[model samples]
Target: MNLNLRNAIIDNVSGNSQDQLEDTIVDAIQNGEEKMLPGLGVLFEVIWQHSSEQDKHEMLQLLEGGLKKQ
Candidate 1:
């Protein structure tokens, strides 16, 4: 069966407040379940798409720092 994970993730979190969204992200990361990665990717994609150039640069810098530690 074909599935649209991006839309599904968005639908599941629809109408969530900022705190709720933060909780969802924190929970997913803390859980570290492989299943959660796609949802997180979708969320990150939304953030990336809407971010300003400077925001994107900072995000990339953070991501680079994160990868260096791994």
Candidate 2:
């Protein structure tokens, strides 16, 4: 058996509008289901790969702040 989760997730969400993407993300977070984490990680990977250095830095800072709040 073989599974390529990242590609599968990407394919599922491909061609979705911005509002649809936001709904998917928000629903995944609100549901707090473990299965959705991989999809979220894949989405984040896409975002991170395309982000500018400044964007990356800001994302890291936001992540750091979120971690500190925990």
| TM-scores of all predicted structures | 0.92, 0.96
Tens-place lDDT digits, model 2, residues 34-67: 9999999999999999999999999999999999
RMSD vs true structure, all candidates: 1.0, 0.6
> Which consecutive 10 residues in model 2 have the weakest lDDT in total?
1-10
Error at 18, model 2, angstroms: 0.4
Q: Tell me model 2's lDDT, rounded to 2 decimals.
A: 0.98
TM-score (C-alpha, index-matched) for candidate 1: 0.92
Model 1, span 1-70: residue lDDT tens:
8988889999999899999999999999999999999999999999999999999999999999999999
